[model samples]
Every structure is written in C-alpha cells, then in structure tokens.
Target: MVQRHGDEQSHVMEREPLLSGTAQPDSDYHACHSISEEDTGNGVLKPVPEEDEEQSIGRGETESVKDNAHVNVLKIISVMLLGIFVAQCDGSILMATHAIIASEFNALKDSSWLIISFSLAGAATQTLYGKLSDIYGRKRMVIIAYTMFMVGCAIVGVGQTMWQVVLGRIVSGAGASGMSALVSVLITDLLPLREVAQWRAYVNLVATLGRSIGGPLGGWLADVIGWRWSFLGQVPPITLAIILCSAYLPSHTSTVDEQDAAATDLLKKSKFSRIDFKGAFLFAALVLAVLLPIELGGVSIPWSHPLIFTLLGASAILFALFVAVEKRQAEPILPLDIFHSKDAILSFFILGFQTAAQLGMMFSVPLYFQVTSNPRPSATVAGAHLVPAVVGNAIGGIISGSVIKRSGRYKSLVIWAVTCSSIGYLLLMLRWHGNTNWFESLYIFPGGFGMGVASSALFISLQMVIDPAHMAPAVSFMYLMQTVWMTIGLPAANAIMQTVLRRKLGVRLLELGYDSAEVAKIISDAVSDVDFIDGATEKVRNAVVKSYIDGLWWSHAFSFSCSIIALVLAVFLKQRRLDGHKSKP
Candidate 1:
C-alpha cells in the first residue's frame, strides 16, 4: 500500500500491493483495495467499532467536557452578557434618563455630558482589553472588567456632585470595553466550528437585546425607586456574574500545560511560545494615544489642543514602533500574518462599516422620537420595539448556520444577507413623508430580518478566516473596532446633522434679510425652550422644527449609504463552511 500511514489528517489516501511484483501501474491500488476489502468484508472502510456509535459519542462527550476548563461557560456567558447589556445600555440609556439624572444632580443645563462621558470612555478602551486578555487570560481580565464596573457603580451611587457621577460613568464604560469582545472569543475557543456561529448568534442576540432594553429598564427602575439606584442596581448582577465565571472559566490556551502539549503536537502550535513585551506595551500605548484624541475631540477639548496633539502624536510614534517590534518578535501579539489574509482585513472594514451604521441608527432613531411632536412611539418604546429585532437576530443566525451545514457553501447566503439588510436599512431611514400605518409596518420587520441574517453571516465568515490559536484575540479585534466606531459613528452623525441644520436654518433666515445676529438669536431662543406652542414662536418655531426633520432625513440617507458598502464587500467573499474536523484551508 502507498497510503501514508503515520498521519491521520491527510486529505489524500494511497493504495497498495498488486504492483509489488508486477509492472502494472494500478496494481498497487488494487492490492490496497483488496486488503481494505478483506478487513471490511462488505468492501467498506471505517473505524472499527469497539462500542455502539451512540455510546462512543457519549463517552467522547464526557472526555471533551473534562478537557474544557469550565463546565458552565455558557452560563457564565449568559451572566457576562447581562453585565454587557447594562453598561452598553448606559451609553444611550441616558437619552431616556437624561432629564431624571440631571434633575437629581441639579445639572439640567449639561445633561448631554452624561451620555458623552460614558460613550467616549467606552470607545477608547475597547481595543486595550483585547490585548490584555491575550496577555493574561480571558477569565482574569473579565474579573478586572467587573471590578472596574463595580467601582464605577459605587462612585455613581455615592455621588454628591455631577463630576463624581461622570467619573463613575467613565469607569463603568471602561469596564464595558472588556466584555465587548470576550464573549465571542470564549464561544469559539469552547465550541466546535459547526456550533460557533449559531451559539455566537445567540450571544449577539443577548447583546442586541441588552443594548435595546437596558435603557428603558434603567428609566423605569429610576422612576419606581430613585435615579441613584439605577447605578446601584448593576452591582448585584455583576457580582453574581463574577462568582459564576471564576468557578467555571478555564485558563486560556496560553496555559503552561497547553503550551507544552502544543510543542509536542504538529497540528496545534503555540502562537505565544515566548512573550513580546515591547510589542504589547507599544500596542497598548498606541491604542490609548490615538483614541484619546478621537474620543475627546470637539467634546471636552478643542481638536487642536496641545494635550490632544501630544496624545495623537505619541500614538503615531507608538504605532510605528509596535509594527517594528511585531515584525521581529518570535511570538507577536498583533500577529502580522493575519493582516495579510484577504478575509481578515476585509472583515475588519466590513465590521467597521456595519457597526458605524448600527450605532447611528441606535442613537438617531431614539432621538427622533424623543425630540419630535408625533412619531411612531416614545423613545422609551425602544425596548419593546427591539424585541422583534432580537428574534430576528437569532432566527437569521440559526438559518445561516443551517444553510452552511446543509449546503457546504456561504457566498449565496452572504449575498442574500447583504442585499436584504441594505434594502431594510433604506426603508428604515427613508422619509415616509406622511404618517401611514402601512409605511410604519413595512420598514421595521424588514429591517429586523435583514439585520438578523447579516449578523449570523458575519460570525460565520469571521470565524472561518481566523487562526485557531488567536481566536480570542481575533474576536476581540473585531468587537473592539465595532464599539470604537459605534461611539464615534453616533457623535459624528449627530455632529454632521447639527452643523447642517444650523447652516440650512441660517440660510433661510438670511434670504429674509434679517440681521444675521438677530436671526441667530431667534433660532437659539427657540431651541432653548421645551414648549412648542405654534402661535407663540410661529414662523421662527416652524423653521427650527423643520430644520430638525430635514436634518434627520438626510442623516438617514448617509447611514443607508454605509450599508451599501458592506453589501458590496459581501460579494467578494469566498465561502467556507466547516463541518466535522476539516475546515477550509
């Protein structure tokens, strides 16, 4: 027989022996086929059964359970996700609770800062957690994240001043950065490829649900109890999550035993046989330095402030050094090799665009209702409206998973996901002009369906391209990007709308030939008041209200365009659906 005997993973099989003494080219294949036939009397070749297949499957299942460091990883994920929900909810949650928190603190004039502080801090630190988890371990880093959150929660609960609460909110957001990508990392590490997408989709469903509902729940809780309890309420859920995760989470694959074992095995190689502190340090500094500017830009400080410039310049220098160190390090944290992979880079931008668009919707749609006279529902209704989206997310993910398993291809499903979602985004963002019942119903469900399908497709495609060893780091990379972009995306969209609205209103007033300063004063006065009595403000009032509506309409158009970019990227993907032990190379 000519088949390779030592390796079981080879895709090719060889035959033997009929040509051993003869000159026949196919004789060796015949000989091997005969031997196989003799071993398997019916001419079938398969692993010999020492036990029934079901019993064998059960025994192997137990061994797998023992091998996994944590038995209740899923439960921990559930708890961790709950924590993620609350923190993420806090970012936009302020939209609903803005008046309440501001009333309690006596800072009604500056309530917007509550939302901004949390969002900025959360965006800046997400990527930092990815590298930290890679260095220490997911389990340890998660604990750190919760501790930070708990600290923030305590600060907010005991606050006597608005700044103290801002500090608390900032701390809570930093902690959220850790939870952002860690869940998906653990999912892939703990499960088989066949199961990764469906399970990841479930986790994503939790994230989306928490994101949508967390705010309203915070609002209702504050109303029923007090605003301070909103921060205090988070502690119990986080405390429980820590206990469950510590008891269940295994040491990362970078553990000494796994590393040693990898050295002996060919298929499993350690990506971190030796640490590269230089690259890691530079990487963290680089991430922090660059993000500080983007996060604080136009909000707390001028964009050209010395502090911002110093931070951004330092970030640039560190990025250069980090790349240099990664090139030389035997075991690198950045894993430069991954950047060269087609799907890896594409997935990054694809995810970046996707998240940016999502963040804009989450922020803008809620604001639309909160500020408007009559809309679909109140801003508080975001929680209930999103329930359908959650169902859609889970369903789309499951359907995508099934399609891959049954058909062994991904491009078609990916294409459909992109197309449907692009149209859905358009419908949701469109100017329906008038309030028709059919118009409302038409957009919401279709948008949810498209979003759900695309969410699943993203997981499948990402997991397919990633190196098995850096699975956690890879997931972290993506999650960090999404959160960062999401934070920036919202502010950028809002900033654009605000600027455009001001310019348009100013132009209309200018055409009437009113003194520029007088026109500015009139518009400013209208915006300051909460009341909207038509005759009181009259012509000036309509201009302000019309400006807001027009700005929102154009903002929707911008978000829809971003979705189109993602749809285009989906077209270039080469499908790979992993089943059994063989994933596409």
Candidate 2:
C-alpha cells in the first residue's frame, strides 16, 4: 500500500494468507484478494451461483483488460527500442568514419573533439533531461529529443568545416543522451519492475546488434559513396521513429486519475519553478572541469601541466559548491539522499569499474586486429572481427533477462556475471597476441557475454533499490556514470598505448639506426593515421606492429586490473528479493 505524506511517498506491504480455491492476488496491486467469507452472506464459504456472480465476473473483466494492456505495452516498447538502436548505429557509424573525417580536415587534433564534444555535451545535460522529463511529460521530451537529433544530423550531413561538424555532434549528442535515458525510464513507467528485465533484454539485444553492424555498414557506405552519406542515411529511420513516437507514446497524465487531474495540474505548474538550475550548472561545470583536462593531459599536453592542475582544483571546488547548493534546494536536481543506501554507492563503483574494463577491451581489441593482421585488414574486416563479441552480448542479455524474470533474484546473478566478466577479460589478455588467426577473435566472446549480462542485471538491481518515482533520475545518473567511466577509460587506455608504443618504437628504431627526427615523425604519423603501416617500409612496419602489440598487452593489463576491482565490489552487493515494495531501511 502507498500513502502520500506531503511530497514524499511511504509504502507499507503485508502479504495475506491464501485459502483453497481463492483468486490469486496481483503482487503489485493493492485490491482485496477476494470477497471475504463474511461478505459472502454466510459463515461458511460457498461457490456463488452463475446467475449472481457480478462482482467476481467484474474482477475477471478487469484482469483480462490488464493482460491485454501488457501486450500493448510490449508493442510500445519495441517502437522505443527503434530509437535506441538508431542512436547506437549513429555512434558506431561515427566511430568507423572518424579517421576519414580527420584526414578531410587535415587536422588529426580535431578528431578527438568529434567524440569528446559528444560525450561532454551528453554528460553536461544528462541530469537536465531527467529533471525536465519529470517536469514535462516523457513523450513530449522524447519528441523534442528526436527533433533535435534530426536537426543535428542534417547539420552534420551538410557540414563543410570542422567547427560545423563539431557543433552538430554536440547538438546530436545532447539529444541522443535524452533518448537513451528516457527509453529506460519509459520502460519502467509502462511495466512492473519484475517484467522490466525481459523487456530490457530485448531492447539491449537490438542495441548490441546495431552497434556491431553499424561500423561495417558505415565503412561500406563511405567507400561506395562518401562519409557524408553515413549521416544522411540514418535520418530516414530516425524520422520513422519520430512518427511512431507521435502516434503512440503516452504523456505522464495518462497514468493520472481523472479525479486527481486538478492536483496534478497544480503540481506541474510548480515543478518548473522548483527546478534546481543552479545545481545543474554547477554539476555540469564540475564534469567539464575534470574531464576536459583528463582528455587533454598526456595527449596534447603533459599530465603535470599547470592548466590540468588548475582544472582539477576548480572541479573540486565546484563539487563542494554543488553539494552545498543541493542540500538547500527545494527540489534538488539530484537528491542528496538517493545515495544514502550503501548499495547505491557500491553499485555506482561496480558500474564504473566494469565500464572501464569493457571500454578498454572494446578499443584495444580492434586495434590489435588491425595492427597485427599480416596484410593489414580493411576497416570492414576489422569491424567484422567484433561480431562474436556483439553476438555474445545479445545472447547474454537474453539469458540474464529470462533468469531474472523466472526467479525474481538479481544479486547472486550479478556477482556471478561480474566474476565471469573478470575471467573473460583475463582470457582476452591472454588471447590477443600480436599475430592472431581468425579464431583469435572468438576469445572476446566470453568477455562480451559477461559484460552484457552484468550491465543489464546491474540496471535492474539499481532500479530495485531506488524509489519508483525516482527511477528516471536514478537511471540517468547511471548513464552518467557510464559516460564518466568511458571518458576516463578510453583516454587512459590510449595514453598507456601511446606512451608504450612511442618508447618501444623509439628504442627499436634507434637500434635499427633510424634518425631521431625521422623516428619521431614515423611515430607521430602512425598514431594519427589508422593505416600508417600501408605507407611504411617492411622493416619499419614490422617494428611498428611489434610496438603496437606490446602496447596492447599493457592496455589489456589495465583492463584486467579494473575487472578485478569490479569483481571484488560485485561480491559485496546485497541481494534483495523482488516483492514490488521499496524498503526504507
């Protein structure tokens, strides 16, 4: 039972005993289990006559409608997933064409911005999307997201300058961020917590497949037409998704009762005024201050640069200010009490560490295949190598969802999944030798499978621990956790690779008697151009390949370390049974 205490919600649950031949009560609903024996107008229970069973018959009608509603909800979920799949496709398409785009601009330095711009923009506005969606309706926000994304894509498709491309990506990323966060939130809104696992699994499977195939498709399109077509082609499907959103997506008011409409309207009017804009700005500044330096330091500038230190210091002060502001806000953008549970805190770290490991492997594994292939594989071939991992990811999500749906337990499953992922990362570390055969790519499947299961299960677990009303913001926070970890993970892994590769190549090239300036140029060129080996002499190519292989080993080692930390954290996660009630303790 749910009782409203001013603005806060309090829940009390008491399970009732079942009698023989009694109707089973819905776990989530609060309706009386059945007509009481006393209410039946007799001391002893007796079956009602077919002619006088209006109450029981009415109950049956309500249940039948509910069952049909669930089927309709599934249809809506499928449409929402179309948007997510396209978003993933857009990202992978960009990844595949990143190098080509850089060469067009004649500025390798600008390439990082293509990704960084998107990520930073996404991070900055993630909380805003959550807060705003709560104030406005979800369907309205979703339509706005699609509109913004489509506009951004059009800008990118026509972009002739580097700045224009960067601007478009930032706009696009902000919209995509909303699509990602709101899809999960909307799912929870439409379905019960227990059924979420199965539906989310289906959505996640589409996302994995879209990302996996997008790279190869992008490469093929870029080759046949041009890189610009990659952006243009995706617009059609996004348009279709927008159309679907308009026709079927429900507003928040759909869930409200007719009698409560006036109260809801009053609440809606006040929600916007109560928004913590100051908290939002401070949070965004904090993210940018820390992440920008991490992205730049040790790549374009030294790690010890005064600018990096300044940004780090500024970020600390901003964080302190953010907390102070949030504590006093009438309605904080991100509530302070959300993390009061130890499970929430621990889950964030486990997600962070696991994401770090997953991203490291995602990047380094592809590099290993590209650099070490004897004749050097095409972008298409390198993309194909990732298929096993994607397939494994899809399978894992399906299996995890099925398990969760059947048993309504997640903690043990999460622990085992993370442990399995750690072992998978270990196997990846062992299998990714410099010269690999076709079979070597299969090694990533285990790691991918574990990651897929763990990621989906972790989301379900996090949802179980938080209030249903807070689901959108909590899920958005989780997405932010992923973005933060990914931003740190990819760059950190690249830094390790660059540092290792430069040192190893320099030492080996000097031994081969190459001039210092020439060696430096070669190393720079190799890092900039993905296909630098194609232009180098046989001896130089072989040395560079060896250096790349060595660098990847160190990167994978970093991934292994992250996985170990995640494994330790996973073991401590407390398992709670899904009984459709929030525990205040």
Candidate 3:
C-alpha cells in the first residue's frame, strides 16, 4: 500500500502544473522520461513514439481522477482550521457557565471536575493519537476525533446530572486533543518549512479568536437561553466542520522515498514488532497516577492524606518502568534519542513551565472579575474582560511569525515573550484587589502577548533542531507537556485560593455572629452559586467579595512567580538559525 503511493506520486507528478495553464501530468517526471528505450542521434531530446503516447495519456487521466478524489491542499487547510477552531472554542466555553451548571444540578462541590475531567482526558489521549496516526493515517484519526466530540457534546446537552456532564466533557476533551496534534502534523505535511511559521501564526490567531468568542458567548448563553445551549449551539457548526473535513481532507502517508527502499523493507518486517504496548501503558499510568492525586488532594481530600503519598510513590515507580520499557522497545512511543541533547530537554521544560503560568492566569483572571466587578455584569457577560488579552495574544503571534520570517531567528522573540509575560503578571498581581476594572486590565495585554510569542517561537525553534521524521511525536510531546503542567498549575492555584478564602470567610462570618458550620455553608454557596451574593445582606455581600479578592491575590502571585521562573530559563536558551532546506544545506 505504501509503495503504491510512490507509484501514485509518479503518475501524478507534474512540473509547474499549478503554474502552467495545463492540468496535465508530465510523463517526463516518471522514470521513462530520464531513461528512454531509444535515443535520437542528435544532442536534443526526442518525443516517444505514438504507441507510448496512449500510455502517457492514460497516466494523465489517472492524475485527473486522483485529483478529483482528494481535495486540494488549500481546501484541506481551511477545513482543518475550522475543526481546530471548534475544538478550542469547546475548551473554554464552559468556563463562565460552570456556576450555572452546578446550580442547576445542585452539584457545586463537584463542579471542578467538569473542567478537570475534560483536560485530563484530553491530555491522556494526545500521545496515543499521535502514535496511532503514524501507524494508521491522519485523516482517519481526525474523523474519529470529530465523531467523539459531537457525541460528547450531545451527551452534555442532554445531561441532567453533574456526573453526566463530567463524563461528557471527558469524552469531548478526548476527541478534541487530536485536532491540535493532527492539525500541526497536517501543516508540516502541506506547507514548506519557511512558510510554516506564517501558517502557524494563523492557527494561533484562530485559537485566540475561539477563546475570545467562547468566554463572552458562554456568559450570554447562560444568562439568556440556558447554559446547555452553549454546548448545543456548537453542535451545528461542528457538524458542518466534520462534513467538510471528511469530504476535503487529504490522506497523509509516511513519506518514504524510493532511495530508501532497502531500509523501508527492513522497517516493514519490524513494524508490527515495534508497537511498544508496555511503554504506552506505563506512560499513561504514570501521568494519571501523578496528576489525579494532585487534582483530588486539596479539593476532595487533604494534601497529607496517605492516598496522595501512595499515588506519588506509585507514579515514581511507573516513571522508572516507563524508561526501562522504552529502552527495550524496538520503536518507542517516545523516542529517547530526542532527549539526548540538552536543548531538546530544555525546550520541553520551557514549554511546560510557560504553559502552566499562562493557563493559571487564564482561569484565575475570570474568577477575579466575577467576584469584584462593580454592579457585576450578567453571568454570561462576565468573561468580556478576557477579550482584550486574547486580542493582544493574536497581535503577538503575528509579530513573532513576521520577525522569524524576516530574520530567521527565535531567541530574541522568546526573550521578549518571557519578559512581557513576567511584567504583565507582576503588574496584575499588584493591581488585583476588589476592583474588576483597573491597572490589571492594562497588564493582561502584555501577559497574553508574551504567551503568544513564547509558544510559537518555542515550537518553531524545536522543529528546527529536531529530525523531520520524528516531528510528529515531538509535537505530541509538546502538547503533553502543556496538558501536564496545566493540570498541576491550575489545581495548585485553586487549592491556595480555596484555603485562604475559607479561612477569611470564616473570620468575617464569625464577626457577623455566625457559627463555624454556617460560615462553611455560606462560603460553599459563594463559590458554588454566582447568585449567592445577590440574595445576601449588604454586610455579608461586602465581606464575601473582600474575601474572594484577597484569596485570588495569592493565586495571581503564584502565577507571577511562574513567569519569573520562565523568564530566568529563557536566558539559557541556545540561539540557532533555522535551515530552510529539506535536507541540511
């Protein structure tokens, strides 16, 4: 089947078919063009006999047929962009409406799982899809992902119980994870190396646009029609996107040139032997064991509980086993060779830590505004404050891409990103208090801009350094790092906010002549139901607002610390010029 694709390439090969008015395939691109059966006495090339003309015409017809069967590259990209846009939109759509969902289901205590389940499930399946895409095909995997997303959305739309919504989100997230990795791989397959930077910028822009739409739209949907419509409304567009993608997306095969036939033959024999099931299991186990415990520790159980320690110990053991399994596998899911260089290792950590910081801010900023806004906006409109930051992110990505295209360097942009992010976080940290609108609004732009620059620059830099054939797995690993760090960062910040909010709320409630248990219930209601403060007396409402503001200040401080650490790490990055040629020039 793979070799048949090579033959297909030959049959359809054309020199400037796209440039020339003709859609005909040139027979000269085939082997017969270079090695003719007969040669003219003159030093000029001669056309083949009319007998061979029939065969050449058949090849031309075959080319046209193949063209009709597969969509053009541009159409494929457009459809893929839509798919990614939908996936990203789904990720943040529920952010502003979680309180509503909790209130309706009477499951406020368990509401955190609505977000965590989605993220965790998505992260878990990313690497799995990357490997499977390599083994099977990219288009097939993407279609599968879309189908899952649609089904998950349907489940959430109809769900009556909080646990049902959590399950639906987990399913939705599992499917959405593939869109990011697969879209990235598709970009590399379709575009030239130098051009990829600009295209990536477009993708980043689309992602930001999705987030921008999601936050405000979610708030609006929750306030007017219902929170469930937020999930249901996405169904029609996503379904349309799925149909377009299925019809238009081109098939991706692993590129194996004829010159490497002998190696290809050897690889074919060992391909089945190289699945590395043990390594896959160990990797999944390690991630789940570590993240689940952290997620549940401060939220569901105490941090010092025996279960947390046990899970941590088990995670450490699983890590060692995963390493051992990789060493023994014929073709490891994660190649150890990629980490042999210090720069590659540093790139992973840089993205991990950087993502953790930004994601922390993404969650915390919205919550800060929800509690402190003067005469608070409707539940659906509360996330409008996030719009400016998202716009700044788009601007930063565009600039980063343009600069890299001109100078062919990423180090300076990386440093700019880190500095901007750190400064933004620091400013926000200082400005955050009881006010929703203030200096904090100004700082969000820089913070978002920094994140945009850093993310694009780091990925481009890593691709430049790594081997091309290994790019898919490397990209998958980048996504994994993002998911893991995000899982850790958000939960830790929430823990801090929750603990402090509980303590401060207790004191305020006690001063107002409430008992300890009554104070606990009120604090719970404050976090669980956005409508709580509206019904409370002015004195209690003021105290509740102040407590939330004070608690979130510490969360912002933690995010600031993360940015500072990322900025310090940026100083150590090794700068390199990207080589644009297919093979090193």
Candidate 4:
C-alpha cells in the first residue's frame, strides 16, 4: 500500500522488496507505492519528525495538502507540456512547409513520404517505447527521445537531398513516438483516470496552440530563412526541455533499497533481457509492411502492383505470428490481455476512426484554400486559416475535460464530439465549392473540436475499463491504433483526391478540345504539382480548380462517413462512473 500524507510525500508499506521475488516486478505498482526517503550522504535515512507530522495532520490540513499537491503536479505537467508543444509544433511545421522543401529538392510528388515516414516510424516504435520506459525508467527514456529528436533535426537541417531529409524524419519520428507515449504515461502515473482527463485537456490546449502557430511559423521561417532553419530552430527549445526535465522531474524510485547490493546487481544484469525484443521486432515489421503499401500504392506504384499485394500478405502473416509470440511472453511489449475488455476494443476503434477523420480534414483544409482560392494564397496565409479549428479544438478539450472531472460522465461528450465533427465535414462537403468565404472555411472548427473532446473522453473511458496494472501498455496500444489510422487516413485522403482530380480534370480537358495524350499529360502535371494550375490559361485554371474542389468534396464526404461510424461506435461505448478509485464497469 502507498500512503500519501502531505505534499511530495509517499510511503510504500510492502511486505517484501519487489526485486527479490521470483515473479516480474510490478513496476507500475512500485512506481505508485515506493517510499521516499532523504539520503543524508552518510548512508543514513533522514526520517520525518513524528511530532511535526502529527501537528500537520492534527490541524485538519488535508484539503490544504491536497491543494498544494495539485498545484505542484500542475507545475510538473506544465514543464512537460513544453516537450509536447515542441513535438506538435514540429509536426505542424513540416505539414505546412513540406511542399516548399520537397519542391526545393524537386521532389514535390514525394512530399507525402515525409509525413508517411514519420507516422510509420512512430507507429512501429510507440508500444516499444512504453514497454522500454517501464524497464529503463521514464526520465531516461524521455531525455533519450529528446536527444534523438535533436540529432534528427540537425540531420534534416544539413540534408542536401530529399531522401536524407526523409531518413532524418524517420529518426525524429521514433523519438517523437517515445515522447508522446512516455509523457502520457508519466501523467497517468501522477494522477487517477478522472484527474488525468482534466489535466489532459490542458495538454491538448498546448498541443493545439503548437499546431495552430506552427503552420504560420513554419511558412514564415521557410520564406525568411529557408526551410532548413525551421528544423534547426527547434533544437534550442528542445534542449531546454531536456534540461528542465532533468532538473525538476522526479527521479525514478527503484523497487529495491539502494543498500541492497545483491538486488541492485541483479537488476542491472537483467534489465535488458526483460525487454521483449522479438515481439517488438515483429510488431515493427508488421506496421512497416502494412503502412508502406498504403503510402506507396497509387503514389509510387500502381495499386494493383505485385509488391503491394506481397507486402499486404506479409503484414497479415506477421500479425498472426506476433500475436502468437506475444501470448507466451511474461512481459509482452503490448499486453494483449487488455483487449479482453469490450470497452477497450471499442475505445480503440472509436479513437482510430475519429483521429483518421480529423487528420484527413487537417491535411485537406489547408490544401483546399491553396488550390481553390482566387488570389492563390501563400502557405502562410493558407495555414493561418486553420487557427479557428485549433481554437475550437482547445475549447472542446477544456469543456469535455471539465465536464468529465465534474460530472464523472463521458458517454454524452463522446457522442457530441463525433456529431460535431460529422456536421463539420458535412458543411465542408456542401458549402466549400470552388470559392469559399472565410466563415465557410471555419467549417473545420467543429471537426477539430470533436477531435479534442474524443481525445480526452475516450482515453479516460479506456482507463476506466482496464486493470491499473495494464495502464501503460493499454495507453501505448491506444496510440498505436491512432497513429496507424493516421498513416492510413492521410494517404487514403490524398489518393481519393488524386483519383477524383485526375478523372475530373481529364474529362474537362477532353471536352475543351484537348487530345487524349494532351489531357493525360496535363492531368499528370496537375496531380504532381499544385503550381501547374498557376501557369494555366483562365479556362484551364478554372477546370483545374473545379476539379480540385470536386476532389475535396469527396474527401470531406469520406471524413463525414468516418465521423458517423465513430458516433455509432461511441453510442455503444460503456460508461463507468469515476469515483477517484480504480474499478471496472
């Protein structure tokens, strides 16, 4: 049992030291339960004064202590949010500037690879990071992730070729995967599921801010100092985040006493072996196989290509083998047992579908403005239009979190979130034609808002249904599903857009008296480069713009359908009341 008495105080009254047991150590439980003792430097444990403790307790200062603890936790979380901000900002920056960077390298058609590389690397390593953190400790893993991110930034900043930049992104994505998963794990460590929801709202707010500003910031940097500086500039703030985390973050407490020489030696010898390397490798392979095909098909190669079919086949086989391997492991990278809960399964799909729809809109809205606007706005101006969506997202997160924290209910919020997103997509499908007013552009706001609410509510709902012991793995799995769908959603949207644009633009060009060969070349160029439309005649420009609008409408229609599916899933999601204790529905 872990006892909490006052601010920054925790005492674990365990019958036996965890390290000495034959069974695997319950690191999560130990993290929550371990005692805190001040070392005198002379190898003596400095104990708290009994009278002082009694006096503090006797004064009925329980609420005061709780308040102080809450404030302290907020401070820690605030510092941690800086890292989240940096990661989110980097993502949005790339989203906004990738076209420019790819064009610089004359690889405009390959720009989608940058985001796909990141998502692929991230999805592959997400659960591995969570499992590794449980072994090596969160602080260590987080700092390592930050260092990796910095290294990736440096590589990208200096990269002369697009493939080098892509390699850098893969590295950065791995680090980002760790950062995203570990930070949430740290928060869940600090709070119960109920409070986690409330604080996560604040996290979402910071992330939204990062994403909102990053687009404009990235575009400005790309214009002023070139795109390379955009990557280089993030290093300093990330370094500061590392330093702050080192200085202020709590140290990981071991399950064994420091004075226990044998246990310490045993732990040092066994930590690496504890990692499920086989499961991790198979899982990563499975993800790469699955996502690579999705990203490459209809972009780099034909959809009917043998390589795509082969990769898909390999992915299916790898998944089965991975499942079989994981079931026998004592400490699987992804604790598959969590899926035994109906709520966990439902939450995963709900989150996946919602995230897919939201990301599709996020990628599409900016492009829609760039392609369809009469003046042909710069990347900065196009990116600025997303501010409303980000703001709405932040607001939705705060509202959902506050409601969950107060009312201890989230089912209705989940429903409302999907509904809002669906409505947003529907609006875009109907109203965002070749020309859209500023107000009409704000149609994406509700989708962003819905995403925020889903982010907080679905997570808390997942936590409520699982055993506390499975929290870390469960959280990692949720992220895996999310990132996997993100990988699928973006490419899927792009494919749909390209397919529609090609077909519509070809038909229009043919009607305009262009020969079949001329129409094919024009369609190819238009699909490959958005700038192709800029040099066209008025008639051709209108045709290109109208074709793009048609493509966007179809994309929005797809997103709307996804949102409706998520809403249906949300309706079936089981609700459990939060009462500040771990319990199943």
User: Which number leads on lDDT?
Assistant: 4
Task: Give candidate 3 regions above 4 Å deviation.
Answer: 1-73, 96-108, 158-165, 215-236, 252-262, 270-274, 433-440, 500-549, 581-585
Against the hidden true structure, what lDDT does model 2 obtain? 0.74
Query: How do the residues 305-366 of candidate 4 rate in per-residue lDDT, one tens digit apiece?
Result: 99999999999999999999999987788888798988889899998999889878877887
Residues 1-585 of candidate 1: C-alpha lDDT, one tens digit per residue: 222223432222221111111011111111111111222112122222222445656867545533442334354457567666666665545667767877777897667677667765665566556555655556777888888887888888888898888888889878876776677665654444555666666666666666666667777877898877777877888888778667655433211223224323521334244455677567667766766676677666777789988997787888888888888964566667657667777777766776666656555554454345443354455334445544665677777766665665666776786576567667765643334243363454444565566656676676676554444556666776676676667767776767777777787777767788988876665445424324434566556666766676666666677678877887777776454332422
**In candidate 3, how many Å is residue 308 off?**
1.9
Which of 1 and 4 is the better model by lDDT? 4
Q: What is the per-residue lDDT of model 2 for residues 1-585, given as tens digits with 9 covering 90 to 100?
A: 222233343332221111111111122322211222222111121122223456556968655545655656665667778888888988998988887887798876779888888888888888777666766667677888887888788888889998898899998988898988887876765555666767778888888877877887888889999999898887888999999887766433222233444434545455567567899999989989978997888777888899999999999999999999998975577877668877777788888987888788788876888888877777566757777777877888888888887887778777777777777777766777666676766777776787778877888778766654455678889899989999888888888888899899999899889899998898889877768898889899989998888888889888888888888888778887665444442
**lDDT at position 67, candidate 4:** 59
Off by over 4 Å in 1: 1-95, 98-137, 250-281, 301-314, 370-395, 401-408, 428-430, 434-438, 441-445, 511-513, 525-536, 581-585
> Ranking under lDDT, best-scoring first?
4, 2, 3, 1
Per-candidate Cα RMSD to the true structure, in Å, reads 10.1, 7.9, 9.2, 5.2
Clashing pairs in 2: none
By lDDT, the better pick of 2 and 4 is: 4
Rank by TM-score (best first) = 4, 2, 3, 1
lDDT of each: 0.60, 0.74, 0.71, 0.78
| Top TM-score prediction, candidate number | 4
